[model samples]
Target: MSTPAALRALLDGRWSDLRERTRRQLGVVELPPHGLDRERHREHVLRQLRVLASAGHPSTGFPVRFGGGGDLGGSVVSFEMLGFGDLSLMVKSGVQWGLFGGAVQALGTERHHERYLREIIELDLLGCFAMTESGHGSDVQHLRTTATYDAAAGEFVVHTPEPSARKDYIGNAARDGQVAVVFAQLVTDGGEHGVHALVVPIREPDGSPCAGVSIEDCGEKAGLNGVDNGRLSFDNVRVPREALLDRYGHVAEDGTYSSPVDGANKRFFTMLGTLVRGRISVAGGALSAAKKALTIAVRHGETRRQFTRPGGGEEVPILDYLVHQRRLLPALATTYALHFAQEELVSTLHEVLGGESDVDDRRQRELESRAAGLKAVATWHTTRTIQECREACGGAGYLAENQLPQLKADTDVFTTFEGDNTVLLQLVAKGLLTGYRDHVGDLDALGMARFVATQFVGVVIERTAARPLIERLVGAVSGDDLHDRGWQLKLFEDREEHVLDGLVRRLRAAGDGDAFEVFNDAQDHVLRAARVHVERIVLEAFVAAIDRCPDTEAAELLERVCDLHVLSAIEADAAWFLGHGRLTPARAKSVTGAVNRLCKLLRPHAATLVEAFAVPTEWITAPIAQR
Candidate 1:
């Protein structure tokens, strides 16, 4: 099960040169020993962050002038690689470099950048992103914290208007942070401007809270104790007007609020959109965690002897069992798929945030929708994959040294943070629906008539022509290759299109009723459409990456991995395919059989696949996995 040197080289080249070097450097760091003492763990992570910062790792995504390489993709790749080690360190680093520092870089004006970017990048000034309030986690618009413009003093008075307005679950707020990028409602004599971000001093350089700012440690959690999560309340905490991170919107010295974007809602959304890189980073980190969990489980399965042969010979490896392959192989395939999807996400993020592309509003919305959907999928997958890996390892996984327990505990919150998975899916669906409406709305009178006619024709063609077309195409290919890339892509695309088309029809049928009620009724259907769309995108990325492989043997092996991923997805939702007539009952049954066969085919490569992750032995300190 040893990976070929050629394949190892190819896998190593998957990330950029900067990321490869960062990964190698991270491997050499001496991590603190694992324990349950939260305070001690927090200190450990803080020390680790300092180490990473000293290594020039945290500055990858910032501007080159600010001691950063200005390499967004490389930064995310490094973050993902770091996840193979201590997740607490990974998260703490993300809070410092990704969320807090990224907020400053992405949202701040040039003056703010010149003043703070270098110091933040160098870890000279620690900060937190103070956005999620006690009453508002996902819903940022309604945050009860207010930043009132004081015209006479030329200051913005930041205050938590109510207890619910307190910034909760804020990383670095408890101990390390000296400043915070606070999101609050902006009020001036002109009007109540929507949510805006301001740089507010949370603590002085002496590690004490600044005047009018009260901080409370959010003691103990399900996991990630190393990250110092805390709550902060502002009691008329006034900051200079220049503290506003006014890339999108700003207030004048005379208390006049203005923005490049006309509407308050648009301005608010534009501001929030700047931080989408955080979502991408989270997804990549979650994928990395899933890979580590699978590596541990698969490696354990490869070596752990479970049952005797029929003739009472030596015990066989657990991986030799069909059930064990079924449990772990598909997950491994999914890890690969997620890896490819995350790469694409990182690239897109770099394009938008690296200032290399002129991304329009439409493109930005599309990016946000995709990031939201993929983050939801990837994090949920991590949670599921880790749980399965834990169970697959049996009792040994429960042991702390095996790392699965800690992996499971730490990744559980990933599903809710960044954005709640459920809410994010809804955002995807909303984006889809809005885009669809806009597309139709853009048509002229004659074009509208033609569009309706075309839609009618499309429906007729779908009902009458699509099935026979697919069947004929399937007939041309060997039944064994039904799980081939072309067919799998078509299957996923068709399923997503079908779900979206149906959702649109259902919404149209609702017809001028209470919009909220209509949306509520279709929420489940909308979520399904979003999930299907994201699955298709992930599958496409996986197939494309496999196609790019130059080594024949490597390509063939990756194709099999892709087969496992696609078939497993098909098998999981077999009932849906069958009910929709997309798959005959016979084909549906074959999907299950195909998945099992692929699992068996891939079992021997399990250890090799995980080894290609190149996790340092120091990072994956799981004893059972080591054996």
Candidate 2:
């Protein structure tokens, strides 16, 4: 029998020490109480924020020169752990370090970092990531906010040109923030360069709004009310030229503009790519929420008795029923699969951004593409799984203290935030069509589909992890054994290739004529391609993880769990396989049968599997889950 400890060692992966420390430290502040007024809730969260900062909890991602540990992967893993605590605190911390502070560290030069990074890390200066606007949410390249260089004054005038330009849904802006990393169009002399970030003050030393700045509370949201989300507008707000975060782009005091990146579009995107950590962080946190939700639901099912057997000698545990297992077990399997995928993603991020290698453009674009796809997949999984988990617990899961309702509400906006799930998927599809052909790589959203006419040769199913092992396993398959790991791997790969081929045909047929229109027409196909591609990546990561497990019994358990995840994914998309001729009618039916059997086979181990997630005891205060 595989012990939970053995399984936890596998799930913890590279950042085991950091994960353990975060759980212990964060457990000190239990989940916030329900029904506190928004003000009280915000105040409570702020106090906790101070406590965390005082202990250097927020410095993992920053440079060592700036009072930080300079551990980028640790920063991401730590944020993921926060998902099991008060989600409001999670979001607030993300804004403070991952976004606002991240922008400064990644985009700003030494002058910017030296002047402000220490205070930002220490919580002496709370700030906002002012990117999203009322008029433009996902369309970030054409923001209406402007930072015009005033050569005579040696300053830049940050202005919100219209109502639509006002920054909306900004955490830390409604209150507590002293500054904002505002994204705006930068104009020098007479020409507009493109959108750039400037560190502009929102609050004065005494905590009053700056003279030309307007701020309004977004007010009680459906969830995360403690985050202090608000709207902001600027009216010719002036900041010194040094305020610009000038890593990829720059402006001289004489009103001259230049950038290391050649094209205006490319330069803006290169600058944005430096901050991909925010998107990756969101994906990790979303999975953490999914894990917590699944843990709660699975624990309850193990002990909560349901309808009795036919003879009525005793009521069976809900987890023993095939139906309840179907509801939670397949989802539990997916949660495990996603956890492995996320771990691989973080490591890739660490290696690429950790300065171990040169900044190759192709690798950079690939990283961004993977980040976008995983973020979309993970967040959507979180939203869907939490709802299912809530339903699994019946009435008891709805109570305030059970944590499911709060988890459901807090994570609902994840699919839309960071970047809308739909848009992110489209970006991934665009990459599949035009990316990696002849070493050409680009990630600009508008130009993403432009090269599809010449770039796409054929589908290249590159394994993201353990390539030799995966190829060996995939090569050994002789028959369509649904339980065979090789067959499952090929199945996912074949489906993804077919989806991309069909999408390519549709787009290629519209050559030289209204390309955007045709791409839009095939939007459904595009999203499906992205989804399947991500599914393939996820399976490879899971297989690679299983190969690395040291404990024999735990690896065996994970193999079955991995089977549950892949079979369930295929079963859910049975129609596609049937229509695409990849699966016979018999095999399609067997997919469902296999999923049902796996769920039943995995039922007895539900508690052990979720226990491996090692969610802190304080966070699981659900009455039904009482130990």
Choose the strongest candidate by lDDT: 2
Error of 2 at 47 (Å): 0.6
**On a 0 to 100 scale, what is the lDDT of residue 132 in model 1?**
97
Q: Each model's C-alpha lDDT?
A: 0.81, 0.87
* Cα misplacement distance, residue 295 of candidate 1 (Å): 1.1
Superposition error at 223 for model 1 (Å):
0.3
Predicted structure 2: clash tally:
0
What's the TM-score of each model vs. the native? Answer: 0.93, 0.97
| Model 1 steric clash pairs | none
Model 1 worst lDDT run, 10 consecutive residues: 457-466
Residue-level lDDT of model 2, residues 449-552, one tens digit each, is 44554666777554576999889988998655888989888888888888888877777676655645766777899999999999999999999999999898
The prediction achieving the highest TM-score against the true structure is 2
* Ten-residue stretch with the least lDDT total in model 2: 437-446
Q: What's the true lDDT of residue 304 in model 1?
A: 93
Query: 1-627 in candidate 1: lDDT tens per residue?
Result: 233544556555545576568776886566667675988888888888888888888877888888888787777877877888788888888888888888888888799899999889888898899999999998888889999999999999999988989999999999899999999999999989888889999987678889999999999999888889999999999899999999887899999978877776677777788789888888988988998899899888978997799899899999999998998889888988887777777777777666855556766777788899999999999999999999999999999889999999989999999999999998887666555332322443233333433453222111111244444543465435666555776787789889878876776676656646767887899899899988977876776676566778887898899888988999899889999998899888888888888888888888888887767767788888885
Task: Record all residue pairs in model 2 with backbone atoms less than 3 Å apart, i.e. clashing.
Answer: none
